[model samples]
Target chain A: MTVHAPSLRQEWQIGPFRKGDIIAGLLGFLVLIGLAAGVGRLFAGMGATTSLTDAYPWGIWIGFDFALIAFSGVGFTIAAVVHILHLHQFQPLLRPSILAGLFGYVAVLMLLLLDLGRPDRFYNFLLFYNMHSPLFEICWCVLLYTTVLVLEVSPDLLANLPWKWPLRLVYRLMTPVTIIGITLSTLHQSTLGTLYLNMPHRLHPLWYTPILPVLFYISSILAGLSLGIIAYKIAMAVRGQKENPAIAIGLGKGIVAVALLYLLIRVGEVIYAGELPLLLTWTPLNRLWLGEILFCSLIPIVLWATPSLRRQPWVHWVAPLSALLGVGMNRFNATLAAQSAPTSAFYSPSLLEWFSTLGIVAAGMLLWYLAVRFVMGSAVKLGYEQH
Target chain B: MTTTQSELSRRDLIKGMGCGVAALMLSSAMVAHPELAHASDGEESDSAWGILIDLTRCTGCQSCALACKETNDRPNPNQTPIGLDTDAYSFVEEKQIENSVGQTESVYVKHQCMNCLHPACVSACTVGALRKTPEGPVVYDADKCIGCRYCQYACPFGVPAYEWENPLGLIHKCQMCADRLAEGESPACVAACPNGALRFGNRKQLLAQAHAQITSNPGRYVDKVYGEYEVGGTSVLYLSPVPFSFLGFPELGDEPNPRYAEAVMKQTPAIALTVASVVTALHLFMQRRQQVNGEATVHITSQKPGDEL
Candidate 1:
């Protein structure tokens, strides 16, 4: 009997392109542009169009963009742990995980530009350096990290492109670039949480601690790992591939471990900061605190720890989705709900701000779809079955 | 073959157990040194700077706010439409608190940058746009600002205000009149305070004065000195007759914000580099091993596979 080796190349070929993808992306882009223009008009009139007041200087732009991006630090945290840490089993989820991070950060940068009073002067960040500002450190690290991500992910693009010296150089340099990327991501991700240290008076005592930067880093990693698992499941389903049971189970266990650690640290923070009394108070803010701890952390732990649930396909889906929602809730509470309390008068977001936030998310998803179609066709090809 | 499979499974079990143990140890270590876990390697500034607000003497007159507007050249808040307005740098808020005698007494709290020894806003500003001056004021520079508004979010005091109304918005806050300090004068608000409500001096001296006031008259003031050790001590200090919370002051712990970031920053480089190096080495090893085994190889084939040599 003659045995023929299965064709790996056949399964991994670039899929056919779809014009509909580009049209949808273009439409989303146009909508985002329209929303941005509307915001521009409002700013041109000196923010008279918005409901923001002196009592609440920060609105949705800061809450969603800054706070949300900080939460999304999970992306880099997971990428670093799985890719750089040599966790070979996690290789299946790395591409999509990093892609999500890329999109999240890009969304942050876009929102930042829109939020700037003088978006034109944004380049001045490069020209001037305030050594005293934590913001200065954050800006440089984020910019450098973004470049590093592009370089690290470029291999995917280079693999498809006609081979050239430049491509070879990039492939050769990928290791160092990835190392630098990890370093930069770590610095800026934690720095985002550290930014709140100065406003101990502004943040609620229950949420505010000296260890927030550490907490932020830990939570981000937990969230990132969970998000990666969720993203992989979705991507695999969309491309019609059988899920890797081993990877799903491995990540499920990882989530439980991280969630337990996060819960312990959160409880420790409340105790160390002498905020246990605040937790007993029956205010709306206290309820948010409870929700963040119970829904975002505790329930996910309970769901993932069960042996039967860990093995189920739906568990992988539900676990990560829950973790993502939990992280989002924690970030929102920390940024808006926890900070703005005792008076609802100071915390309501303006209509334009809300529209702009929704537009950014919509536009990000649209771009992601196009990028996946064009730049990341291989990601889909990875799961093709052998006959 | 069955024996080999069992041996392989055993090895896998051992490896998994090792990972579990390592994770357990890491978590324990992290819990023990929670504050030190994320410490970044940055030079801690030599001189800790701050401010002192004497609430007992404040008259609730808006003179300091007026002086701040004039000094900063901010727009008039009253004339400018609600959302369009951006004038006051240091404003006073009135709060009615019931004392031990159960009488409602109105208290005025002056709000401004606490100028934390380890300022979160400074850490939050990725571009180094907002900084803590060595002389003890948290200041903002427009040139380095990408208008991220991270400073606004990171500030526990909620002092950093964005000029959202401006097409080219910049962050606005009281620099404690840094320019005036450079010229050897007190902050505009401090100099303008009619009743000695705001005092400008070296942080050490101000702190001593605050301690003396609280110690000398126990019942006259709260036992606490507001910014003395909060958030690793602030440049600004506050003294009040009522509880700080009742007067709108946040109850902050002693740990500074930078300590948190610093701890994580310290561990990240080590972990990241180690992981990257190991992964790179593994990848290289696999590639070399495959080449030697003659199982998988990179071939630069010309044309399609069927047409190639």
Candidate 2:
């Protein structure tokens, strides 16, 4: 019997898996487990499957949902930079960021479905109109913007098609579609903060402000740009190509500017709202609030603003990672920690909740990796390459 | 980069500034007069029904809570409810308040939906599932509820409860017996009250009677009615011997909870238009500037060759 070595693609396809394959397999396993856990939760009801109580109606599902939506701002944010602002130098990162945005939103939609008690009627927002409701506005904006993201990211796949007209059509409609995406993102991103406006009685005084919409919108941009750098680096690495350091540096400058503004307004709001005293109280909630600002805004601002630190190789990964964590913490804090339960009942998400959430997120990462490898490889060759 | 091009940019900047000023002015005017942005509940106030609960007369019999469970067809109808839940729509809370001489006094307070004229839940519900009716009850439509539980955060009184035990749960809350009222019958809780603590009547008349009782017997009741002006008034009014705050009622301003949120939401269309037009204009302006400068072709991959209209 003659022994033959398997080709790279064949090896990837067959049983002799490599590192990437092992990672993909692990993610796939988690996704399958998550599907089972989700089904179990759906069949068993919220009371049995989750630790959520009437006192704390929302949990990790909502926390991740809100954070993922903010992270997905990369789609419109990068599009606005390249197509709208005409910053052509940042073009290389565009497609990858849009792909990231698409999957981020898909993951968010999945979490939302799992969170909804009546998941079957998730489309009810379309049939009913409540112009006065912040949630109503957010629902419409998310749905429309997800559609916009699909269109924005379609060209990556469309480029691979044998037909030419579909790609041409998408490119022709790109500008207006991008503008619409930006508009929708602005509405929902800010409206997420507006959702909290109704909860003055429940939310801690430190996080509750009339300017929450402003803060939320600004942070989305900051986090979006931060995530964009990470996405660009990973995309380049996946394609086995070298990345330009200038891309991260340029985006870092923008992140710095946004971070400064966020920090100023956040602290300024606290002082203006006369909640500075609460900040000094040393309560657990106050500590969490301070930590969020420190991680999400203050540290990134310092790291990116300082020339020497910004150039450091580690700063590239550390700063953006911290910013992402900060934003995630902010969302979780807003959804859970800052909320004051009327009763003594506390919440700790069940194992099923953890497994299911991890599974959905893992699936998104796996899908993004696969697309970046196969679809994006050819798509980039077809002239997404920088001149 | 030329002087004439800079001058043209200045001119465009001025035009953009003009639009910004106009938008700011328009927003300020809307802010100055909130009534311009205030969307009415579409329910006539004149014919609204209300409940008057005189806590000074409640005996803590737990009869109203049981009757509410029975009327709503909730589980364990005979069980005494300790708090608001999917099973119990209303419950009487026992509180310990200090007397003027510093002696502790026990007071019984009934807890249920406030049914505010400007209900935050109705304003925050994603699908218009919750509605403030012309007859003054804040009702819910289960079929329309996606069970997002946004209402749980929006309610000032923390009234709405979710049936967590159900596979496909829906929000459950005290609807003030809108169905019973339709049939010219009072709420089961009100009718079942043995101490005459709960009164069902026209809201305006109830307000008048509540004030009359306060004035007629000095020191018997608090000078203020609990729900009369709380969150822009509720369909239910409460008369208490002790302060409502001591009974754990959320201290609230007269302005409704949804006021700021609704005002911002009402600007959605305006915000969307402004953003779209500004972005479109900026793109056009940048493309024009690049063309005027005759810079080597702009290399946006998304805008490469086929993107041109």
Candidate 3:
């Protein structure tokens, strides 16, 4: 195979002051502010830094950590689609989605560090063993899967190196690494829901069910496939190339099936649990539950399933974004709203939490774009085109 | 020659990892199951220590709370703590209840850790930082705790309180004076109770005494003991004139809180093996189909650089 050396300096050019630079600049600024906020939180402690109390030990940090992990399912989900299922027509989207997954997990790790009361003991989960704990399993899976992700994305980096052997070795190992990643992801993504199973007393009945693990796992795939469409479109745009419309349409079909199945089980469990009456109550919590179903399941299913609506260019963007938002809301609602605190005290996040959360998100976007513009630009396409 | 050898090695690697992951998960599941199943047993041992609190006794006296602070060496021994916190491991909750004649009356209920026989916090803790000891106290090891606070959600009684004021905080709860028990003294709260409101004894004897008190004192005490069967029996028992729910005790079932979590957790190995097997099977099937369709296997390094999609 003859390798074409990329024209490196041209891709790195930022002096023309384009729109991408401005977004990058803004994200960079937010990241700086977020770093400062994180430092303040670590120094002053949770009591002074955030509105979190004993009544609300977990807040937006956990909410996003859970959501991001779901979103990051793009890594394994897409890997499964292309490598495992041998659907190579979707190959161009793979690298970008995996990169997004890596970034999402990194942001989750950062937020988790901030959320910990003892951030210094972040590695304590590794030292301790508690197989009975859902969190313990999640901790181990996240650590292992992150390593798998680093290896998955390393090919792009290795291709740029003077030595060719590293890339060759990784290429040979891709099939096993991908399978391992999917297996590990299956454990933790489902286990995130299992984390909530312990809190049956605290969680609202409408959202709490014995099948929470199943619900969480399915929604992750829904979110992952939706994000894949977005990632593919964005990656094409970043590369200054036109996207194949067939890819998004194909993925949209997959989303509808998963969304319908998810809706069935999610609502079916509530009925099975005899909590359907709770859904009709229209209490604030009930309304939130209905909203989750509407956005997460109803709207995505309708938007993607209808042929006329699916063909519209705008639906392409709106459908997937709607699914992503619904999944995000579900995670946040599960983490915060569904919980019934022992005390009557309500939680409102502090500015520090808001800033730091935004900053971490900004940092993730910035790194993603930088990689998209520089590191991932031609190498991934070249690798796929050759295959 | 090189391509064939590398392909064979990669397949071998896949098979090896699949088995290794399954084994790891299975071994962890095996190690974890027995301990979890044993922990879920709610029946109290004959030798286990227990606390029996009689709420009908004449006192809203905060002496027990003060003694608790002193014994625990918490900061504010003099201050009356209305709720449990890092500085106050135990507190007396004052409630206004209507008597039989419909007139309001004051009742004080002392609150502390229930030390459940099947403690959800111990099972939910990421680090196994909280443990149910054979001596009947669920002790917390601060050194092992990373302060993830999953325990706070797991405790039905809302017992574990975080030291939110500290930058590096740890969970604080009543350890039922394990040190005092070791020294052959009763818990400080029981020792300091001016009235015999708090009784310390072996669980079996205390349970019998509680039943006897209810039977002997015809209409004086509520027939039900609050902790006798709540969340599979708590070490701390309570007797009151009113239903325990009116005094803000959580209504719980006989099934323990961690039952679902631990049960699901024990299936981790099985889940892993099943997933790995299915995915590997699918991969192999896909590869076989592609070969049968007369398509070449796609490898990153095997093709020319400029091929069309």
Candidate 4:
């Protein structure tokens, strides 16, 4: 297990800034400026600045938070497998997953601040805690879990340090931190769904179920497996690393089992709750609901369930991309469509909103590139070359 | 926040951990005493106040709306067609309905906050910004409010209004004139009602009076009292000649809004702690077993890359 330090010349002269990077940086800068102005006007008045009304108090920001967190499920899933679950094979995927999660959560915090009518008062969740509110619990879990994540990812940032004692201490605490991170992620992911439980009539019949928390938890696991696979493959492709079939097939099989279980529970819930009747009545909402079921769950479940299909390289790549969309769309539907049933209020993210979302994602990608190319590059390079 | 290589002290860490534990204990204690959350069964026992709005007695005059504004120092009413806004605390809605004689007649209904026995807004508020008092009013403390607007979505009646036009946003809703009630004065709307359409009294008395009116004159009033059983009985009671649904009230069941969410929330603390402990224990066991067995726990297949899934 010998480590090779790159030459100073090699470190200084990696790939020069490309055209795509320039364009992305320019776009991100413009979007950040707009976001600052938008946030400024938001203080002037939420209703005046955004499309948020009393009927639709939450707009794209809340839904965007849900989507980002849902997709970030890969981080905890990978960490648990490697550190706590004792599956040493998935170790290489851990850094990328952690990077994705850290950025994803930072984006969520940014969006939440923008959405809040009084963003400055967010700390009140800690100071004047109301334990009854699911939002309160979510705040606590997010705050605590993010701390664990920072600690878990700290070793990567500090790997270049001459001293070894700090790194050893972090390594010793890794198992506990991973356990805590999993706990917090599990609670908050489910609690986000619990926020909807208070308003059954507000949620469309398609999503209103007592087992919403259970659904959220299980689907997150499914999303974790699929998202991790997709992220790993994409990173490998970007770095010119070959595919790891062991990792891909292992994740694909897990996705199949979880997807089937989630589909089963969701179907049973709707039928038992007498909402299956809505499926027959074919309204636009019902059609969208059907689409979520068919595309997100059923198709992916079948694709991953087949052993031959799982083995194929195309399926290995495409199935995860499909699953990411499926899971992301599910979050969007739950956050927007489910809550919009009672009122006629409609929301499409403003041009500014869309630009801000794009900017956040681009910023995340840029950060990932910096971390990998500068800080964690050698580790990733070695992992790819060896395994 | 930067600490030198050896400047961090053990005492500092212990002090920080102690504060953390105290905060956690305080929050858990607040959660454990569910009675504070159940306002109707706790501090509200002295006198559960209520408002009885008799639609049969209402003459469509906008005096109540006017009086409410004057009392609350609300802005000019620019209520939308659907009614309810930051400026207007209450409004009169016009509805066209056919009478028993089959002739269409316009009915004017007054709308305001329901102030439910178990208010979803109070439950939804993460910082105790909205609260239910024993004197039978759901109050808003803007000082504590984070302007999350979750109460806006949580309220069944859509009662809580956001000051969206203001640079500083906060919730606005009818607090049933808590100050007036304290001073032994009826609400401005009730006092100003020229037609005696609104009645204020103890909640039990209001319920009894509403029932007597329904049972006494069967055909004059509808069989159902609008808020009597809706969302687990609001503080406001309504009796109408026409079905309440025609006036745009949501058709809700008797179960309260809090009851639904509490069903899951009640178990969350236990579930979260239990899951955390169980998972940590399992992780430790695996760690110990891996140490003892030395690379025999997880079996990765040795088959070729093209092996079947």
Q: Highest DockQ: which candidate?
A: 3
Cα error, candidate 2, residue A214 (Å): 0.9
Native-referenced Cα lDDT, model 3? 0.85
TM-scores of chain B, in order: 0.78, 0.84, 0.90, 0.82
Residue B6 in candidate 1, Cα distance off native in Å: 31
B1-309 in candidate 3: lDDT tens per residue? 245645755775566575556546633543554544446754567799999999999489999999999999998679999898888999998899998999998889999999999899998999889988878899999988988999998898888999787889899999999999999999999999999999999987899999999999988888999888988889999989888888888899988888888888888878877787778778878877886696876766654564322
TM-score of chain B for predicted candidate 3: 0.90
Best by TM-score: 3
Expressed as tens digits, the lDDT of each residue in A1-387 for candidate 2 is 258865766433232334666787899999999999989888999999999888899999999989998888888889889887887778887878888898998899898888998999999987876777787778777887888888887776787678868877776566667777887798899999999999888888889999899999998998899889999988776666688888898889999888889989999999998888887777899888888898888889888889999988788998998888888889999999999987777899999999999999988888888877666534444654233
lDDT minimum window of 10 residues, candidate 1 chain A:
A378-387
**What is the C-alpha lDDT profile of model 1 across B110-150, one tens digit per residue?**
88777777777776565666666678777777776766566
TM-score of the second chain of model 2 compared to its true counterpart: 0.84
Against the native complex, each candidate's DockQ, computed on alpha carbons, is 0.20, 0.39, 0.57, 0.32
Give the lDDT ranking, best first.
3, 2, 4, 1
lDDT of 3 at A23: 85
Clashes by residue pair, model 4? B44-B134
- The CA lDDT of each predicted structure is 0.64, 0.83, 0.85, 0.73
Better of 2 and 3 by TM-score: 3
Off by over 4 Å in 2: A1-18, A383-387, B1-44, B100-104, B299-309
TM-score of each: 0.71, 0.90, 0.95, 0.89
**With candidate 1 superimposed using the best TM-score fit, by how many Å does residue A265's alpha carbon deviate from the native?**
4.0
Q: Which ten residues in a row have the lowest lDDT in candidate 2 chain B?
A: B30-39
